[model samples]
Target: MGDTSDFDRFYTDLKETEKKDSVLTSKQQIDRLLRPGSTYLNLNPFEVLQIPPDSDVDFAKKKYKKLSLLIHPDKNADDRERADRAFDVVKKAIKMIEDPDELARCRETYTEARARLAIIMSEKRRKQKKDGLGDKIPEDEPAAYNKALWVVVTKVFADREKKRKMLEERANEEKRRAAEELVAAAEKRRKEEEFAKNYEESRDERRGTWRQFMAKKARKEGEGKSLRGTAFRPPKLKLETSGK
Candidate 1:
């Protein structure tokens, strides 16, 4: 008998532990929904609702009602704090599922995950066959397939979030630049207006200064004309003959 692959061994163990999660109590459900890293984990609506990606909107709505009621703050008075957070998560998930675009995107992510998993399985199986091992792949089973799909979907979501953050940063930078330019333009306009106002307000001063300068020049000219009109009589000359 061929030795079982590690991949197969994992699923074997996982299958043993798989239980019907539908019977979990309200508190257990709350804890599960609010677990560490649940922010990223709950991004998947199907993951949040604990439903299959292929589940229709109607089925999702039913699941939403159940989970929402279970974790609703009013219903879980003793644990209302955590219950509120959990409720919001469930509410957001249902909204996404209800959105036609979001729902389609969720389905596409699953479809892409499945397609990629199929290719990977085919390669693994081919390699196993070449090595003289059986062509069986663990992920061929439903449980293993679901786990693999979850991993793939998580990676896809992470990648999309990174790209979105980058785009948002770029958009924010553009908006900042636009705001700065607007402020700079406004300041420049304000300075120009102030300068014009100051120049206008000083108009009378400048005109008065010009009139004073012209008046002084005219007064000097008049004094020169009066002096020139008088005869240049040398101060009455006292003729003193030099006595030899």
Candidate 2:
């Protein structure tokens, strides 16, 4: 009975190990599938939540709210490792599709990817036609095509987003500088106007004082002459000379 119990315990441990190994294998596969360069499949909240491409504005907002809550770092603290990665991807994807320029870039990337895929497919078809094996085309070609397209799309969108952020920063800097310049110019103009007004007022005050002084002197001369009613003569002074 003791041997049997030991065997059972060993078997249970083996099974547990096998289960752990299976889980690890699955995690590895998921990591590989969602690798950094996967594609431009917009990992945004809306996209991640599988909102339709033509979803209404309100619906998109709702989708974002739902997904953000689910993947928020705070809410998924126990699984923060995965949640953070997913959140970052979602954030980047949202920003990529939000701004007009970024959206245009996304569309351009998609177009370019499609064009490249079409060219490759065309070449393959031509080759098959030439060899009379057109009917033997692989069923997985479409998947391969999509994978390649997305890879390019993702890279282009990422690059464009970086550039867009840089441009936005530059624009903000320019706006700040312009605002500062305008304020400085306004201050300078105000100072100049004030200085001109003060200078003009001072000049007028000085002119009035000079005119008043001249008037007072003239009035005093007239009064003296009127009081005397005649011109006054100067008295002669006696001079005493010493014997040389």
Candidate 3:
């Protein structure tokens, strides 16, 4: 609705005509969401809502409500678990469209996908033009063109998904590495503290032992000097004069 009307129109046609040919029903989408290896596939909110990424917020809200009601656990009791999962995805999609930054990201992906398809379509048309045919959806081969367009869409989605997974994996790896580093740092600090504590205790014990040894040495030296001075005294002559 801002300055991307053409892009929005192309996306609308892709979903309504070509995309619908692949069945964009609530049940069908829910099945896909629950399928194995769908974690990355479900990252695209536009695909989750089965609508154009550039859709108005009001339209997206309406779609969310419709899909939520269709897949709400209270309504689908028999398949409640899968239905709940699907409902959660729809709710997440609603939130994504409501968030400005996330909405921009989805829009960016959609724009890139559109540009890729446009390039492929133009090239095919150019080849046709060179072959003496007009540069448009060939009238004689509507089915083939539609198939070609479908193939392009599938490939775009696949490529987008692959890139999304790579980025996600890289982010997770960084987080894991950070956590490991944090733990390692904590352990290193603890060991250093323990070593410092042990060193302080050992140092105090050595100081105490050195002080005792010096005290004993001083006492033995004083005893030896007293013995030397007493043994050198002239006592025998004084005893003889007292007897006489």
Writing each residue's lDDT as its tens digit, candidate 1 over 184-234 gives: 999999999999999999999999999999999999999999999998877
Candidate 3 local distance difference test against the native = 0.72
Tell me the deviation in Å of residue 42 in model 2. 6.3
Give the top-scoring candidate (TM-score).
Answer: 1
Ranking by TM-score: 1, 3, 2
Candidate 2 runs further than 4 Å off: 1-75, 79-109, 116-140, 208-244
lDDT of each: 0.83, 0.60, 0.72
Candidate 1 overall lDDT versus native: 0.83
Residue-pair clashes per candidate: 0, 0, 0
lDDT of model 1, residue 6: 62
Candidate with the greatest lDDT versus the true structure: 1
Which has the better lDDT: candidate 1, or candidate 3? 1
